[model samples]
Target: MLRFNKWSLTPFHLLTLLLTLTLTLWLLNVCFNLPTWLLLVPIALIQFLSFLFFHTIKEKGNIAVVYYCGYALVIFLLFKWFNSMAITSLTYTQWLGSFMMVPQPVFAYFLSSTLMLSSMFIALIYYFVIIHFRPMVLILISALPATICIRMGRPTVSSYLFIFMGILLLLYMYYCSYEAEELPYTVLPCTKSYWSTMSLLLLCIFLTCSLLLIPGSNLSNPIHTLLRTQVTNHLQPNYTTSTLPKESTATSAPTALSDTPIFEVRATKPVYFRTRGWDYYEKNAWHVKREALSLGYQLPKSEMNQKLEQKSLVLLNVIERLEKNGLLQDMPELTHLLEAPISPITYYAAYVTTLNYSHYMYLNPPGLISISNPFSPLDLYLNALEICFANDKTRPYPNEGYVISYMDTFPASNSREMLLIESLDPSTYNQLINFLLDRVWEQHNLQQAQEDEYFLKKCSDEMETATLHFLDIPNSITKRTYDLAQKITASSTSTYEKALAIQNYFYNGEFTYDLNSPVTPLDKDAIEYFLFESKRGTCVQFASAMTMLCRAAGIPTRYMEGYVCEEYDASKGCYIIKQKHAHAFPEVYLPGYGWRIFEPTIPATENEKSPLSLILLLITCLMFLFILYFLSKVLSEQLWRLWIVRQEPKIALEAIYSRLLKRLKKNGYVIEVSMTPINISHILLEQGIDLTWLTEHYCKVHYGHCSCDKTVVLQALQLYKFLYHVHP
Candidate 1:
């Protein structure tokens, strides 16, 4: 048997253990949403026993085997419990599907058990294979939980604290490893050198601050992007799939409206928040082929129309304010506001939850605006003012809100007259154009410079171009769609009238507005299915049908997806937008104006919640509060202990004394509950150790009722330092 000397646990060892345990508990609290006390107390007890077991055992090989087997057992038990609960089934496919549908409690239970088992596995590795753990390995181990928290979107103050502590632990571990190698235990140390440790810590702090100052520092790193993508992909399957509308695509299974609030906006009036647009239509999907237009602060002459210059300036001022207030530091778009042109109309919005999609939310014709945080590089397409984040990077939509100014254009006031003129005979059209030009010249009191002929030609060409753009549709469009379009518009005499006829066909209770309707099959046409087969669908289906009908009727139309804020809350002083508000509508491009908003879906009542849903919600809230209370209790206890260690000299003296005994036990020295400081000191002295001064002072303060002063506590600490350098 190899005789191992009992090692004294220094203040460093005690502090490190406490910090690591606290950090572990905090992470578990955040990630699992469990009661901290439920996890902390048992974990602390087990860690204490494990440390003692490893320290007292003379055979290192036995220690390795025992620790590994213990962790393996724990992992086995976790799986057994999970299986017994029926949270996961036997087949892989069934297991995955069931896991995705697991309720919060079961999910939390599963995650907590997994994390705990992971920690134990890491510990096993550290003790068995990697007996001489490197600082980098330790840092990586410490970062695992924090990484999980970030990936799960549960970042908390504790998560950051864990990172900071991990960095400090890296420095401490490096110092320990270096000191052990350089200074032999037999030699008395001259002095402790803290300069290197302090210098390294300061350098790390400086670098962290510098990184924050740089734009996209957190997101620009290749390591961060890779890690985030891997974690997101791994975990996304376990979460609920998003129901938000995507670019015109084959419809998926219908989903219920989530009562979860997404964002809130304070606007002068209700407006549609558009995120994406589709220009080209396939059999069942809409696609966009145009590349994004990159614009900076200076607007091009063509895009500068509609008083966008003034709007851009207003957005710039808001961005400046947000930047000054530290709210826009991460908002890359706001930082480069001068590079993009925006409309003059503006509103303020704040996010209540993270927007899962990469697209930026704006009104139908989004213009220049300021966001509260930075994002990854964005591509802004001109058609429908569509914005999409670059796919090469992973830019999640920021949870912060922004004050945005946008421009909105309504249909031309004379659109009706333009439609009538285009339908008139050629000689009648010429006469009408001449009459309009003469009236315009007379009203402006302008000189006749062949102005009537020029005006007549310009108006005719503009209307003709607009008509062709809006009416362009694929020849593959079904015969059924063409027939329906003609039948709906047959009674109408003008373009605007034809568009209205199609819109009214869907809106006038002709089709059922069903959010829970089955999806249209991929092989079938979505418009045909919605219009003829199902005759029941949500806004996306309704909008798709109307857009196809209008396009077939020679009216220019595009599919648009956005949020509609129909219900305003006066008490809140803002419009509350929820997942249920996600809407899709058709926009018809009029000849002389722009795309006009036309609603084809009839308004539907809110979905009534069943008693089971209400019960589940109540239970969730109760569980949240219950866990929160225990977490607060655990934190308060730890804080109190820290306060006593720092502020109370008598208590600090006692704690140091207790740590000495723990050190003796760790070093293979037997300690009894009845052993006094004097008895322990005698045993140490017999083994060529001296802690006489510390023993005497501790005894006086604890038993003799002698007051512990600052000098006395300092003397005890000084005496205890010799153990750090002594060898058995």
Candidate 2:
């Protein structure tokens, strides 16, 4: 007890030691993968014992030191566990690809090594002057910058930082010692003020980072594309593609996409992308038909336990705009709808949602674009096929060379070939061409219809026939919208001219696109969202609306879902379809020829107006931002103030000085800050400065272990204020 000075092992010295040990252990772990757990054991044991046995007011100074050091130790060990788990989860190769996203182990080293070294620097200065105040602030500020730099670079940076810090700590200690006359041990410590300030800063920082780390309500997929080489590089140092040897193993089957470039496609025209199919729509859900059962039909099963197969042929291409649906480049075309195809033809399709680990079809349900059965008599049929290649050698989970295949088996290829050969075999090739030409010319009898001034009659005839088949439009609204369509195409005479005009009208009308809507009908019986609830819907709604309206006008029309090109690609030299665009248009089925595609949704006005409310929305959003920012600032400031107030001073000499001052003033000798409390107390004892009041108050406030009386606290505060001014 005689050798123990409360002034020794000050707050500044304790913090310095803590920062030094933490940084060293962290760096060693990073460079050598050394055991960080071993270093934490003794630090933890000492802290536990210190807290259990040395908690009294007389030993409170030591306890505070132990507490901060213990905190630093626990943080280090926890980080070590996190680093080990992170590293173990990935292969050495995967580490390189993941380096930037999760740099935890590197962070651990910086936190441990720099913090310990910085604390040591501060501790030396504290040893002499014993004012742990400003140095603590300096150390914290420097630590942040150090952490950032070390994280960006190598583990050795932390070692260099600590060594330099050690030099600075020793130099600062020498300066403080020279500046002091007899050392400031006679001056009492303000342990409460120091610890309080440190605690507040730490609390504020922790709270701030925690809040920032919390994710917002909405989230999106952040990972897009990663290079395979990047993953391999981390595992193997100094690896290069040119230097790496290639695999020479021979296999009977060609690997999927092995020789194919990642981004290679030969199609110049837009085509639908095809994945697997879901044929069963039940319980408000669409499910893929298991091989054993489909729409009330069981497929044949073989002794090998495999189900009978359905052959299907499907062709698809990546669309530029399909990413909006979260789909990849490949999509399924055949069996996309319930109806059978009318011909062996190609179509485009865009589907939403990508695959997960399990091979299943997940739909975002956004409408896909596709085109099928342009003009043939026979309908197309489709069934999914699973084909697996025999070769692939990637690591981890074995890469399977499996691909989804679509087959169209009806009106078999052999039958179609026979039909074409029999039809043309009776005539010479040139004679067959001449006969087709003569038939086409003979059907041009419509040239005389213009002489009858029968344009209006023709329109009415089309409308009447269309109403009987598809349209549910009332005569009055039908006339008005039809006139609106005519006003759009008032100048057109030919089929192309009329088609463009109708396109302009629908584009200009108050039609909307919606993704989340119940199925509704169109035409004279157009299903409208509540008359006031106007919003642009998805492609399905937009296409359905146009088809119904055109049918009411006596126009031959059909809705087509297929890929549409968003832009004309210079390299591809055509409109490249990145995504499927479902479209509905009028198709005039002519007498001699077949149906031709017509546009109906094109707006006459180039700048399409959006029906959205904007100003009020902006003001509401700004107000939310201001409120969140204000609350955060206020919380941070108040928490800081509380932390500073809670600090307990290290040296009991300050309490002793305070008590002696109270006694001196009561005994008629005015105490001052410039006057050392020890010297003043000695003089008073020699001259008898009656200390009865002070001894009683000090015992009650400092050792009674009960709440201090307000009166006594107020008296102490008044005494310190008076001494501060008088001593200065």
Candidate 3:
């Protein structure tokens, strides 16, 4: 019964095309590290299918609004689901994706979807403005680019893509408008159909562009190297011959660095070396438990080594040649890392000569050095066991039990002489004397042990009250900055601490959590959401939070509102802070310490630091949003009519009364667009306006059946003036 067109593709054919296009783009994107250009193919085909489906159905009046809203909601939700799992950058993909590129496809899908949605959203806004204003299409087209250039210079990829797509649709709309003019579809011709068509086309273009241009960046290309390297490493082990197994059951031979070395201590008595203590083990990683403070238990003076000792903290600059390696020369547990780069391979170059991924160079080889102790005599601890760094050049043959080992007894002193650690919360401080005690307990357990401490009613308990305080500021002005602070310091105590915490958070957070900051869809909570709601805030937001929170916490926080010191201050400057941007810092109190500086406005990224104009930038954003909102509402139908009617009514009674009704919108009075003349008169009078003359004229004409007159209208105008000016 159905007649098929030769050129038309069936639903099944379109569906197959959509799937194939999606898979092909994804595969190509992964293989060649492209921008996933093919990702748009499926989206375009789907859009066409959607159009076809909708074309078959008829929409009238407000029903179309529901249809569009439903479409947007579905797309946004789907995009979010995919975005949550998508890989955003190349470096990340290589480092983590080599094992699984599952997220990359997710990333591709969302990137495409987000971009498309953004374009559509902007197009919708543009269409609405045009429909509401009915501006000359040519002027609007010109204004789009002009405003873009004036407001935001040097458009970003997302913006460029959006504008480009929007403009193309705009041109199509213009073409349609011209066509509609040439061939009017209705007897009483109006440009509504043409404008409507244009709006729809623009929206479509925006959606398509957003889908094509969002996500992935050229900057992320280098990350492919890491991925490729990781893949290669998996297929081929990079360990030296000594680290490899020779036979299944033979005794492994040890290399030069395999044997443990002993070092003497200069202390008058023996002391224990503080090696890293392990508490919890899961997924081959160590997690240290927080130690509970004991008010009752105190460190004995005897335990404190009073003897003065000095040792230069040797710095080993390292350039990691392998992913498993770190920036430090050796894997020392106690050493604190300063300026730890988010990407070790990239930042390592600043400290040492770079080595290729394939090369192996040890700046500081494994060795033990003699350390002076406050306790034991140098001779007594001459052969004490300690942690030493090694390249693991051992186990040339088959090895069994474990790869590493520790000493069984005190090297040169009685093992019992080791001090026993005391704590009220022994369970919490799993280390303390527990490491040694646990071993003893295990042995005892094998031979039948004593009662459990808690079970035997030997444990004591204590508690502390939690206190909360916030630094409230006047007006809603501080909400954005303060909200950001709240998020950054959600885990912090004290305003001073929170300020420092927020500042530290920004300094440690992220700059580009995603490589690019793309414009999102309408549902996206605008820039303010980025600044306040999701407080992985920009530099200014971070800095503002730091300052404000510190101040609130009773710490001295200040907004460093100025340009970055591109050069140092002219004279007497000590540190020569070469700031290239605006920044804010909080001067926090630390009991005995007067004030310490904390920066909160740094980009939240592993390597990015807070810029010097975050304050200025924040203020600018605030102003921009305010202006934008104001402009968007300024030319609305209600606003425009109010503007026109506010002009003095110089007409007769009926006309003056009509104008008065329109102008009432200024005071939040809604004279329904279809208000009867009598109703308009009643509303004006009820609203406390002096409309006696107009009401009298209305009653005479509407109810008393008297004809309308110019004299009464003139009187109504005078009354309107009196009411609007004298008592408004």
lDDT tens string, model 2, 25-104? 44334433334566566443443333223222334566766765665576557555544544245543355444333323
- Each candidate structure's TM-score, on Cα atoms with residue i matched to residue i, is 0.43, 0.27, 0.22
Better of 1 and 3 by lDDT: 1
RMSD of each: 22.4, 22.1, 26.9
Runs of candidate 2 exceeding 4 Å displacement: 1-477, 481-497, 507-545, 553-728
Q: How accurate is candidate 3 locally (lDDT)?
A: 0.32
Which parts of model 3 are misplaced by more than 4 Å? 1-36, 59-157, 160-612, 615-619, 626-635, 638-728
Q: What lDDT, from 0 to 1, does candidate 2 have?
A: 0.33
Q: For each candidate in the order shown, give its overall lDDT on alpha carbons.
A: 0.51, 0.33, 0.32
Model 2 residue-pair collision total: 63
Using TM-score, rank the candidates from best to worst.
Answer: 1, 2, 3
TM-score of 2: 0.27
